[model samples]
Target: MGEEFLVNLKYSPDIPHSVDVIEAGGLTKYYGEFLAVDHISFRVKKGEIFGFLGPNGAGKTTTIRMLTGILKPSEGWVRIFGLDTGKDILRIKEDIGVVPEMANPYIDLTAMQNLFLVGRLYGMRKGEIRERGEELLHLFGIYDKKDKKVRSFSKGLRQRLSLAMALLPDPELLFLDEPTSGLDVMSARLIKRIIRDENKRGKTIFMSTHNMGDANELCNRIAIINHGKIIAIDTPEKIKSMSKGHTVIEVSFEPFKFKPGDFAYGEKIEIAGDKVRIHTRYPDDVIKEIVHYAEKNKLKIVSLTSRTPTLEEAFVHLVGDESE
Candidate 1:
């Protein structure tokens, strides 16, 4: 657990120079017969924050693991800065940094010790480690508690330490999986600002997240995955425009007794008294389904209206079935 606490961030990996920081070609993975990731291919240019988005079990994590060399792919190939991920994984990782999903710093050690452990593992001299580590601690606002045992730290503090450790080496390429998955509001904001700052400083970032707002704001381009495949890939503006302001339908059923499962047309369902507010992309289909359900149940239709989705309501809509 203590060893796993080592975090890394890079403005450059072991590669001295490269145009595309990451090149994945037909990356695929399987757990025996169950395919976790299909033939997904993409390129991440240098210095841009690329977002990976998907619903639960959509192969985002599997892809990241393959990119970072944590898990070997079942098929296909990947290159990091022109170096083959399958062959030169160690070299590719030498100067890069990663903050895995829910990554944690060593709770058993002090924050400074955790940093030192990670820095030494990266082959940094003590002086260099101290200089860079202290700077990151100060930058992350954890300088005041650098000597405190991380076991006593809050979740937010542990998260900040993880990022600090990752950036200790000043890497040029960074990979993060759900960097702000379960953080407090302030912590999340602070980490997001740091991520943007890193990218601004010419560091290439590959980040996977479930937060649509985060993806829309932090990523220059995004790829949405579903069912082990790349369903969509485009700039956030273009993607949001595709599903802009999801169709919202407000219907009042006379019976006022319908389970949420009774509707399949809506992505989200909420009920209050006689009203059911459904958020969906297919408003017309949902409306028809509501009418049909009411007729079949021998109930009267109180009222039905289609409401425009708010700008803030825009989120990437998954393709295909809604399982999981």
Candidate 2:
């Protein structure tokens, strides 16, 4: 069994262990007089998924473009694999796969043809292209539609084909921007699964997304940006811990007859139908008060659950404060 497992394993020999695959220092960007990205410094270790998270127009795309060498940074620098992006763009690009936001495959070509074109652009040989393209199509679950014209495909199919094309060369690092944006449930899940599989194969992934679920599920470390500034950077658990002793308690009653203000123990309370969500720093005290209130009102508690703060909550807490 061990031998069989070893035989089936795939490895990326190019990525050095325990090294920074991407490094940025004081990275900034300006469009004319308006600042698009403020000074941001971060490092992405090899073989980990690093998430860049922010709302729309928060300089996420600008940071990605600069790191990919598509746009010049107005100040500071980024280095990939110890090579400066400005000076070694061609060399750096050879080992990186990029899936930009809303990227589309060639409409006039078939899915296989699109992969073939990408392979050719990377100077892959005929046999190499054929083998890798087919593998990528199968990996992305679009092999059966390989010969179908891209124009006839759905948005999800097009996005999958674009990702397949990006993976044709089996690059060491992948840069994905909102990879699941506008995708349906199944499509989004499939994309996320593929990302996890790629990370297991030792690929370094730098991803930018507004989807908090994706970041919480996949990222080893995340940087939260807002208004051109990165306000927080850490593991999801650590960032969520910034909620600082806050907890959310949700309760459902057999017969609803209470208003949010009637509790008078929570920092914030929200009522929806038969359910109530209470936020508080002292969960035990709040729970005791809730039990006392239920007994006094002769109400039966149907169910109750307590939850820690989520990535979305942490993000909103950080960015919302900045906005205010």
Candidate 3:
């Protein structure tokens, strides 16, 4: 594990047993008269991947800035590693890494140089910087381009380099804001894989993104925020279950001749050529009705499947309600 290769720091083992790795109480932020973040409270346990999910302008970045000591909260407090953010900003920064949204490395500097700069800023010795920088570059699949100036790199490569820089310190807590925001599939996949690998090594991660698929795959628990307020917070399964009572039935028929309205049991139905999606509270009732209709019309069922609401659906349901 990468943790084994990280520099050891003096940490007391006798810290309070109930201290969360990250905690916030009534955290709020404002810009003039406009509230950027409403009073919100949450805690991130040690070694857990906590996701902050919301649409753009949902105050996800604002909350992260305050927590990371880059911004002061208007009416609350945040503690990291049991140290108050306001009182121990420098001490807390040493143990944390942050990759802000669309962060860019020094364009004129080579990738290796960027890492070296970050390492020096953190007061790492020259030998330590070179060795660790090489490891991080290789891990992020950018070692081959380490000598190339960042200005010539593609967006995906730049993003990868940004992450590599963040990891240079081997931080215990990582704050990533939209890590995979705008990247090709391969690049996004690579970033997500690294996140999983890091989590396996017992690092706590706090990620903020609007990408539901990534949130579902990577997050242990997700908090949905909108309009500067958190609407829900729980495991993905529990959040999805909140949209219960509606089962989605996907069916394909050989004949492919069926109108959505023909299925009376469905609360909503969507038809696309040979495939039909039926949303209903009673899956059995809907399935029976479809089977009977198919049999009567001599339409053979090619395939059928049923699924509960997905996280995306739950998000839409929750955010949509809040918007109204």
Candidate 4:
């Protein structure tokens, strides 16, 4: 298996014990009169990529800001690596890596210089900063452009540089906010590769993203938040299973109309023109039943297909009410 596959695989040892690297207790944050986050509570285990997913203005960013100590909560509490963020805000900040949604590397400085400044801000010595900067730039495939001013860099290049700056400290927990946003396919793939590689080194990740594919690809578990609340939180399979038990099979035959009475397959019948859609847990049973019924009724069954629900479908099903 590839390294990406391995990083995403669930191992017995990967299960978390009492030692949660990130824990929030009824975390609520308010901006003026608006409750941006409402009594959210979850624990992110050490070395696990816990994904927070939602649409824009869904309080995902607010929760992240509170956890990272950038914004204090109006109520509740957050603890990072067993240290209370409110009490040890400065200490927690020093031990964490953060990649914000925006790539704001110093526009005037070269990529190397930008990284050097980041290392310095993290309190690394001159030589250490220089070495780490080079290593990170190289790892992110931006070493060749190290001397180029960030202003001259492409959107993808700047994103990679921002990620490198975040990784400079080798922190135990990394926060990535829309890490793959605004990047080309190749650049996004590179960033995803580094994320997996870092997780393999036992660094936990807290990712907030609108990209479901990225969350499904990288996260061991994901929390879907909306309207300042979490709607679902679980493994991808479980979350998807909550909405659908089995695939829906659709069959179409020659232009044949049917009276409501003609379709008698219990709970598995939706008639439209020449097609019938069947909803059932047993694909084989449905196929046999449909075939038998069609044969008995002297109707020709032209085609049949079964399709599993996609995560997008599950998300729509769960959040469709909120959308309305």
Better of 1 and 2 by lDDT: 2
Cα lDDT, model 3, residue 255: 70
- After superposition, which runs of candidate 1 have C-alpha atoms over 4 Å from their true positions? 1-16, 244-316, 320-324
TM-score of 3: 0.91
In the order shown, the candidates' Cα RMSDs to the true structure are 8.4, 3.8, 3.5, 5.9
Worst 10 residues of 1 by lDDT: 1-10
Write the residue-wise lDDT of candidate 2 on 1-324 in tens digits. 346543433333442333678999999998999999999999998778999999999999999999999999999999998788988898789889999887768899999888888888889998999998888888888899999999999888888988888888888899998899999999999999999999998889999999999999999999999989989999999998787547888998768878757887887788866789887899999899889988999999999999988888778887885555
- lDDT by residue (tens digit), candidate 3, 111-164: 999999999999999999999999989988989999999999998899999988
Better of 3 and 4 by TM-score: 3
- Poorly placed runs, candidate 4 (over 4 Å): 1-18, 244-246, 250-285, 293-307, 321-324
lDDT of 4 by residue, 94-138 (tens): 768999878879999999888888888888998998898898988
Off by over 4 Å in 3: 1-19, 321-324
Top lDDT prediction, candidate number = 3
Candidates arranged by TM-score, highest first:
3, 2, 4, 1
- Please give the distance, in angstroms, between residue 166's alpha carbon in candidate 3 and its true position after superposition: 1.0
Q: What is the alpha-carbon RMSD of candidate 3 to the true structure? A: 3.5
Taken over the whole model, the C-alpha lDDT of each candidate is 0.83, 0.87, 0.88, 0.81
Q: What is candidate 1's lDDT per residue for 1-324, written digit by digit as tens?
A: 233212323334444455778999999999999999999999998778999988789998999999999999999999887889878877778757988787678788999999999989889999999998899999899999999999999888888899898898778788988888899888899999999998888788999988877887799999988889997788887665566336678888776768879988788888856789898878888988999999999888888888665323444344544544
The candidate, 2 or 4, that scores higher on lDDT is 2
